[model samples]
Target chain A: MSCNLTEKVSLLVDGELSPVETRAIERHLLTCIECQQARADFLNLRQQISAYTPALNTQVQQRALASVLAKQGRAATRASAQAATPEAGRRPARIFGVPAMPFAIGMLITAAVALIVTSFVFYIVFQQAERDRQQATNTQANSSREQTATVNQPPNTNNDNSKANTFGASDEAANGKQSVDQSQQQRARGPVNSESENRQTFAANARRVRSKRPASSGTALARNAGINAPLDLHVPELLPPHEASAPRYITINATAPVAAPVRPVDAGTLAARHVEQAGLLLRAFRNARTVEQDAAADLSYEKRRARQLLYQNIVLRREAANEGNVQLASLLDSLEPILIDIANLPDQPHADDVRAIRERIGRKNLVALLEVNSTALARAYE
Target chain B: MASEDAEFTMLFQEFYPSLCRFLECLLGGRASVAQDLAQESFLQLHRTVWGTIPVGEARFWLYRVARNLALNEFRRGETRHRLFDRVVEALRPRTQTPEEEYETQERQELVLSMLKGLPEDQRTALLLREQEQLSYREIAEVLDVSESKVKTDIFRARTALRERWAQRVRAIGASVR
Candidate 1:
């Protein structure tokens, strides 16, 4: 019981034991002298310790304690601060307080360059397409301008009318009447003049006459007669010299000339036969004269036939004359600058070349001027 | 309510100083910290006496709370030691002889030095029995050990302290010779 009482001494001082337990330890302590002495010793020691262990107000001592406390708590303080996160996943953890700048700058520059290059390529393609479209428009405009020019051509001049007369007669001789209308239709295709059509008609007539004879005599006669006839004759002065050609030259079936020949069929008799043929043609001409005198009694019918022929010739001539004028106008339009250049100023690098250029310019200008002035002359002939 | 206030005032006046002094001793003689724990204990007691706490046992509850506070302070640091010492000095009679006071202080130093030499469990058991006056069963409850274990630990603590005190007394006698 005393052993138990000794263990209860601290509890008795603290009053931690229940009333029943306190009484038990107290009873045991009163009976046990050793336990009582042990209790007194414990009390004395505690009282003494109580004196020395208390804190007093000492500034120097408190400061020293505070320093030690701070040093001990520093690690825990820093760790707590680092662990405090308001929001997470906003930024990557910095390695050493430095950010990733190089990669981000490179990405921005690459994006900008790609945008500029794309725009530049598109600009180039669009510009090229615009230029092609402009060129096509210019070509279409030029073609329409040429068509308008053909529709607006004027009447024929004297030279054109003369050439047309030759063309119509030849057209009659070749295709007869069909070529006359066809020639007019050809005139509507472009601003061709009467002279060019006449030239073409005469050429066709000559071709027809040669083809029917199978010999060259008729061609020679027609050509020679055309030179001496009236201005209304179907003649082109620029006729081909085919009569002088080897294939077209007459082949005489004669023995020899008068001096060398001893045979009955000789060159003199052949020559006489030719003279007889000439006489026969002269008879035909006289008979036509006699018929012309007799036609004075019935003039209106004959006059009407002549006028009908003339009108047909006139129609052909007008279209043919316009065809010639169209060719000249095209040439003039191309050479317009040359003519204007010569007339406006005389400066040129080569004197002779300039003189030649001046001559051609003068001739084209003269032809254009003469044709304009000679419209009345052409009307008079018509 | 007026009567209750007067009763509360009598209880506060009676217990405040004695409870502070007892807490100082229990806290290894640190008076400033002991006073703080004592005030907290008194507040808990006040709440219970006023019917604020729902539990029936008020006195036992206050004693348990105050004892736990003093134990926790002692475990926390040596700062409580100075607080307890100062409180004990203030509580002692001023008319006591200087020699007696010195003898009492010397004995406490000797006991504390001997406690430092013992293993922690033995020192704690002896302190609870000698200073706090806890019974073997109460010491067992506080230490969370068997009552027999507390008795054995306290016996060993007393034996070691007696041997150390004898050695010190012999050394003093030899010096006198």
Candidate 2:
């Protein structure tokens, strides 16, 4: 084991191992002194190599930036000059050679249009400012509520307090009825629907992650990730910490839909849904194999939801933040085939397939990420 | 246009240090060359239709162009080892530093020389993988190679360095004996 696992040791250090394989390697490393020495050497080598970073001179960088800006400015000036003239040796294009009265009418119409556009823009701006003010006041409570649910939020400015009091009376009524039905179902299923269970867990975890790395990584991760946290940027920092830090577990409540407006899922929203959905799938994959082998955990809803998200992201040209997000979307895209296969399986999934799923989850370190993000969400909930 | 300028500035600030370090590794430790190439790369990006390209992909494009430029210059002067040695010597402080600092400097020089000894692709691949902490796919994107080739190149590079380190230890052991 000591001699043979040298290559595997490298893989282990690099985290190129399934949970099962990782467990095996850990157990082996406990007794293998030779392997331990190899690990030390490798670590030392890494340390020495990493120490040799080239210094960046800020003067050179500033100079470079100015050069770039000047170049861009020159190009833009050229473009603008070209745009100013329609053609050489030709008069300007016109709709017609009409009377001065018609030109006066056109001027009046243009003035009216401008006035209307200005008014409309002012109204939108006012609404946005008003919403921002309201959000600032409710930041505390809404942040706490974030633990129990993540919504298909309509722009952060869509503070539903006014909506709950005003429009969409029928929509609220329908949602209330659905909530009742879900509550009734939960009663039958026992305490599995404990609303604050996940909230309390994630909230605590968020605090822990916040405490662990207070400076660079901690703040960027959205430790107390608000309900309206945007995945618009493919910030690896915004994702769960990818460092090989030990992840702590906390309970997160299932996202219970409340009386909120149901915005239709666009491509961006669908990708956001998958990122959310990936967390739950990772958590489920971690625990499912151990629990009485009840393969049909009724993930049919999530399966369908994830499948819909997949279709929307792919078919609708869902612009991810970047190629990093494209990779994530592709991972989610690959999950559709797996979900379809999982749906077709019998009540109790075959052990082999379950192992395959777990392996996929472990290889991606999805469990750790799920823990990291859930912890962050819990902190946000607080 | 102001927003675009700010965007370019932000990208420059974020990537400048890492790009310079990566270039230094590729161009055999010439810090000035690394700085120039990195600036030129960013300058090229600034001149491009950056809105059409993804930021991550744009970063890889910078690395790719810098790599090509370095390789071209290397071809012009077939003395990569001499270049590496010159930079290492120049970078070494004349006055004595702490024992730890000296050891670190020596280790860094050894690493650069070991890096110099490897094939160009293997060296580039290894540095991208370990130094920049880029994923194999990312290294592949930057180097314009297949993912499998990136993996093989990294593996070969690591093995060579490991063997060299082992050889050094064995030499020290024999001398002591």
Q: Which predicted model would earn the best lDDT?
A: 2
Q: After superposition, how far is residue B121 of candidate 2 from its true place, in Å?
A: 2.2
DockQ of 2: 0.16
Candidate 2 runs further than 4 Å off: A1-4, A31-34, A74-257, A260-382, B78-103, B172-177
**Model 1: runs farther than 4 Å from truth?**
A1-382, B1-22, B47-63, B74-93, B115-128, B131-134, B141-145
Per-candidate count of clashing residue pairs (backbone under 3 Å): 39, 8
Candidate 2 structure quality by residue, lDDT tens digits, A200-303: 32333333322332222112221132112221111122113442132222222323423222122223344443444445544544433233334454334334
Native-vs-model 2 lDDT?
Answer: 0.53
Q: What is the DockQ of each candidate?
A: 0.02, 0.16
Task: Look at candidate 1 and tell me the lDDT of residue A67.
Answer: 42
Q: Which digits, one per residue and each the tens of the lDDT, describe model 1 over residues B87-123? A: 5456544434889767766765565566667766776
Q: What residue pairs are clashing in model 2?
A: A198-A251, A198-A252, A198-A253, A201-A251, A202-A378, A203-A378, A206-A375, A224-A380
